[model samples]
Target: MLSLGAGVQSTALLLLAAEGVLPRLDGAIFSDTGWEPEQVYVHLERLEKEVATPAGIPVYRVSAGNIHTDALDPAHRFASMPLFVKNGDGSVGMIRRQCTDEYKLKPIKRQVRTLLGYPAGRLPRGLFAEQWVGISCDEFTRAKDSGIGYALNRHPLLELGWSRTDCLRFLARRGWQSTPKSACVGCPFHSNAQWRQMRDHQPTEWAAAVAFDHAIRSGAARGNATGSPLLGQAYLHRSCVPLDQAPVDTVTAHEWRERQGSLLDLLDPEDGPRGCSPWTCRSDDHDAESAVAA
Candidate 1:
């Protein structure tokens, strides 16, 4: 099974499998966070109709729940995202992220178990499935073992010595040049350019992200249990301000300097197009408070 993120790297893997360049895949599993930009869903549909389906591969859609809805519900035990926090003492911090594990990985693992014809608990001995991940050579640091014995993680891209550039080129040659990075619409890890892209071209999703940013200002609910309320406000943007009012349009001095250099230097190492995958989350080493300070 291929862990299809519907992003550049994963999409390339899917296409390779479809074209028989890679081994035939039994299926592709996309674990939806329910807050991805509309383009991701559209791309998934196109892949299913024009690629995967034609190649005799099934695509499975699984989800634990709608992350946006769950985060807002007072009754739900909110799985926290790494929301930028502003304290009354004028210090910045971030909530520890659990959304990736709960919303993304758990559902995909459950589906894998079911596909393996085993119950939710332990898998039978000596029976494991080969699960392909889409980590490329450029992002090799993100690659790791599956940890679980039931599913062995595979990195075909790394084996092929492919990079993100290679994936983009392959897709562009196949007439899929506009594949959007796959991440939740309200992901706090979004760079200013990504936010600007959504704001300028995808206003509906941008508005939704803005509203979600505002809604989470008071921080996540603690269900019906009695607990200390959040001492500071939360924000979706690294600026620790409201998303709509963030400095998305303003080119920072750092960005300006990078823009003056070669094309490769255009991407900010700290704030580039790091799409979130179920296996390779973009928030790996992100420090929201430090980002705000910088």
Candidate 2:
């Protein structure tokens, strides 16, 4: 019961673990941040033969143990972090809450605290795990509670009420339709229609997030983990006129709503950095969708 790899909520948590309803198939994690998005590894290889080989469901990956621990760990070094925007001269837009808590929730709380046996380096004396956080109870307030004791979160699409049209009728009764709403092919929560489908279908991840936003802006600095360099400037939302002039979505549907910012403010953002935290996602490496904060 994990489903943070987000191929239609990991095929609706493997259709509620093939309708047994999650007795135990605790797998499908997918938290690697080597700049993802070749259709998120082709929907995690068609969600591992449709949800991990017909309900075996163990597709883990939380790597990032190189490139200098992924560049001082601003969450797998999307060339220095700090998204969560509104700063089109409105000021006050700072992201980087540690890139989904160190590349997606510390390797999913070290694999659900070693499968609830506990004892990983701390905190396992009380609620001895039961994590199950796919979070689609229409995101029941990002369903938090890591008070730390093993855990105790549990949503299972809000205890089987489910929405987003019951996750599209349980992924079209397993024929499936769409998925791809996870993150990190330059994920500033992409939505100028997912940055025109990653510059019209993955031009090498839109030229590697426009050469990683011009290689972290020529000197690299998103400071203030007590380093004191940033002043709120990083562009991966394509053609705010930065990363080598990237702004050509052929805008003429009335200038594409001034380059997009109000489908209910990118799905209910009053501040910004929108929501998608199945395991641990503040989501980052910006392209420009919006909403997934806290």
Top-lDDT candidate index: 1
Task: Tell me the alpha-carbon RMSD of every candidate.
Answer: 3.1, 15.6
The worst-scoring run of ten residues by lDDT in candidate 1 lies at: 262-271
lDDT of 1 by residue, 1-294 (tens): 999999888999999999999999999999998888888999999999999999999999999899999888887887889898989997888898899999889988888899999856667798988999999987799998888998899999999999777877788789887777889999987777678888888999999999989888888765333474677999998788888888887655444543564443322222355688889988753532124333
Regions of model 2 farther than 4 Å from truth? 1-3, 20-79, 82-107, 122-170, 174-180, 184-193, 196-227, 230-233, 238-294
What are the lDDT figures for the candidates, one per model? 0.83, 0.55
Number of the top TM-score candidate:
1
Find the 10 residues in a row with the least total lDDT in model 2: 264-273
Candidate 2, 97-143: lDDT as tens digits? 55656666677777776666663676535646565666565446666
Clashes of each: 0, 14
RMSD of 2: 15.6
